[model samples]
Target chain A: MRKAFALIVVLVAIGSAVPVILHWWPMAPDISADGHLIDQQMASTMVEVGSAFLLAQFLLAYFVYRSADRGTHENIRSIPGGVKLAVFVAVAFVGAELLALGMQGQRAWAIQYFSTPDPNAMTIQAQAGQFAYYFRYPGLDGKLGATHPEKINEGDQNFFGLDLEKDVAARDDVVSAELAIPVNRQIRLLLHTKDVGHSFYVPELRVQQDFVPGLDLMVHFTATKVGKYEIVCTQLCGMGHHSMRAYLRVMPQAEFDDWLKQKASEQ
Target chain B: MRFKIACAATMALLVFPSGVWAGTITGKVKVDGPTPKRKVIDMSKEPACAKEYSPTDPPRMESTITGPNNALVDVVVYISAGANDEGVMPSQVVTIDQKGCRYIRHITAIHTNQKIKITNSDPAIHNVHPLAEANREWNQSQTPGAAPLDAKFAEAEFIPVKCNIHPWMHGYIAVLKTNHYSVTDGSGGFSLKDLPPGKYTVTAWHETLGTQTQQVIIGGANETKTISFTFKGKAY
Candidate 1:
């Protein structure tokens, strides 16, 4: 019965590792231009972690099988190098793995956050409220208008609270629920929250950032592919958190220009 | 017969000037100055709602609705003081429907602890958010064909409710302690009935034009007192 139990444990361990080893369910495809660096870092971490997990499980199974006693008494013995070797291996392996991961991860993080956006990158502002996201683009003047919280009358669809009648810059701001960008062109996004805390998450772009109530956060990325992707809120802000989502459309330069022109005309 | 005697006694009570009878207060709310033009709402983002309106005719903002002769609509009139029974919640439920991405009633009145049934009648989804200061603030989303959302306010408050998904969709839920309240219709007419004979303060509140209060006295049973409120309007 003990042997059979040991056999079952080994079988279970193997079964669990098979799918992971075969790469059955991989991550969604990377569609961002600079996402390969982050993907590489993720892959390296997965390999290291997967190896450690398999090794630990196999070691556990071996210990269990060896410790199973027979009818006759047998003398117990310590491992070859005893406690010293075990401690040394644990510290050395863990320390090395962490150091490597941290170094590579720092590079990936620097590429996404540390570097400044390109000079010609298109700038847009995204405001997240209770359950919806509104994107604003500067019109002909290329200047964003000032936002007045008190002037925000949603009934008139003055969502950004721009004093268009008073503020010259506000008169040309174009607001939309969908985010449209030119493919292969860098875009810088300024994130603001109208009320409580919320997050902007785009899985395809490998971009996620929280919208702190008082702080203004920014993220920049270039989409390599031209398609429609989903931009969802990750933070639990309010009752409509589950349905808080918008479409991110990446189109060709001419198409994006036409879309912006049409939107501007409506405004 | 016992039935004849009861009927006679009831008839006597109705005929006699009993001090226990309730009265009604009817009034009209009007604006004194020029009314602001309602801005056209751009519902282009919500295609489903935009399709509900003709391309040439879109829904305008209903914040400051005014009719001919400066009659104000969507104004809430309620007894602010001198109520015999305070915090008496009604048994019936008040409903607010979201249709075509707009609140069916611009202003809804309910007593404290009275159940409010919010229904989403449109094909698209909507999030009902009430920004209540005295009462607890809450937000809820309802999808198409989903069950109605139930809510109740614990305190009296003038709460502004809006759909976060459709920012242009806005309404008000006035939670009052007394059941004697009325919302002005298109003709700026409101009637608060079943109000006991007493000296009470009647207040009228508009979403944009602000609020006005007047002290009124109900003389006797079956008496209908009339009152009028005039609010100053802003050009902008």
Candidate 2:
């Protein structure tokens, strides 16, 4: 009987280690924006909860099973401090878990959606269309030029329909097919849409924001990687939704300056 | 004046076939053996799209032009290197209508520099977004009964066109340098006209099934060649 109980303990230990071994395998990793943080939290919680329950249940089962197997005529002797120790340990572990959950939840809530951009930070207006996003820079003057929504025509070179007669700043507007941002800068994006709803998702940097037509949304991110990444539309806008892809150039400050100059010349 | 000249040329070509010294490249894309399995278009994200239409049927959707009967609607048929004029006649205008909230023709072929007149016949406003690497990306909106949106592609590329409002709306614009290419019918058949006698690599391409290249030698003018390409299955 004692040998059988020892075998159960060894079997349980091996079973519990299975999950730990599988974690290192290259599984389907989440590649979406905000995917890293969520994946890490989920994986860690699984390990913590799994280990805690497995250890507690294994001991409890062994004790109950061993006690039952004792001869019917034998009188059972209860350990004096066993119940107290179990209760104390269970409560303390649960309390610790609750505390950790509360702290993590608070941090996630605050960082995910509640924060506002710095007042002096750079702001760019993003307009989501059917198949591509049209980004407009606020020229030398840091204010949006007066736009007449009635006259937006890409064929006639009036894409953002700036009332140049009324707002001189609109005439100097710089627009590009690809988005270029400087690395290590605090950037805020003001997103709006002229047509159907589209989502702006960047997996590597961990940011996904939906562009609502009637309402404008704001997204902020600091580019850490200095390579070109794709800005894919997660939300299906139309038939061309799958092909509605754009390039984002994250470059050093000098190269970004040169690109801006080249775009300015074309505009 | 351009129409009158083209009419006169058509009559002249009909009277004297040997005058042009060009061979007719004709082939049919027969959806043979068994009707190829229809692809299930994933419209899960679009709530307002018409649910009654089975995905197995080509999406009855359009932006500038409607596709040929539900069979691969946006198949781009073009002549890469061919015996044709470098300049396109501006007077030849092909009007692709967006009626019934869809494009009239699913596949449209245009000369590299030729203009395509896109008219929105529906009452609501629609934004035309062309997905193409060959041309500058542009999105423009057209209202009902408004003056047609005349747009042009400066280079040769297969541009997938769509409307932002209708998530199911899809079509393709096959911009070719030569004016000799012709789109296949529902049976997967295509015909290229006015080819000077020479050995040419004839190819058939589908949006779903990739391109199948075949070699053909054309010796006699106005020669008819029967070529067939069968694709196993297409990967999404």
Best by lDDT: 1
For candidate 1 chain A, the 10 contiguous residues with the lowest summed lDDT are A70-79
Q: What is the TM-score of chain A in candidate 1?
A: 0.90
What class would a CAPRI assessor give candidate 1's docking? Answer: acceptable
Model 1 ranges with Cα > 4 A deviation: A1-6, A21-23, A59-79, A149-153, A156-158, A161-166, A265-267, B1-61, B64-94, B109-117, B122-158, B163-168, B174-205, B211-236
* Candidates, DockQ: 0.26, 0.05
Runs of candidate 2 with Cα error greater than 4 angstroms are A1-102, A157-159, B1-236
Tens-digit per-residue lDDT, A1-267, candidate 1 = 766777787788789878877889886778898888878887898889978887887787787688777554565567678989989998999999999899989987987789999999999999998777889999999999999999987865688899876899988888887899999999999999999999988888888899999999889999999998888899998766886777889999999999899778666
* Candidate 2 CAPRI-style tier: incorrect
Candidate 2: global Cα-lDDT? 0.64
Q: lDDT, candidate 1, residue A11?
A: 85
Q: Candidate 1, residue B126: CA error in Å?
A: 5.4
Residues A30-87, model 2: lDDT tens digits: 4333446656665667777777777776776677576766776877577567989979
User: Which one wins on TM-score?
Assistant: 1
Share of true Cα-Cα contacts across chains kept by each model = 0.36, 0.06
Candidate whose DockQ is highest? 1
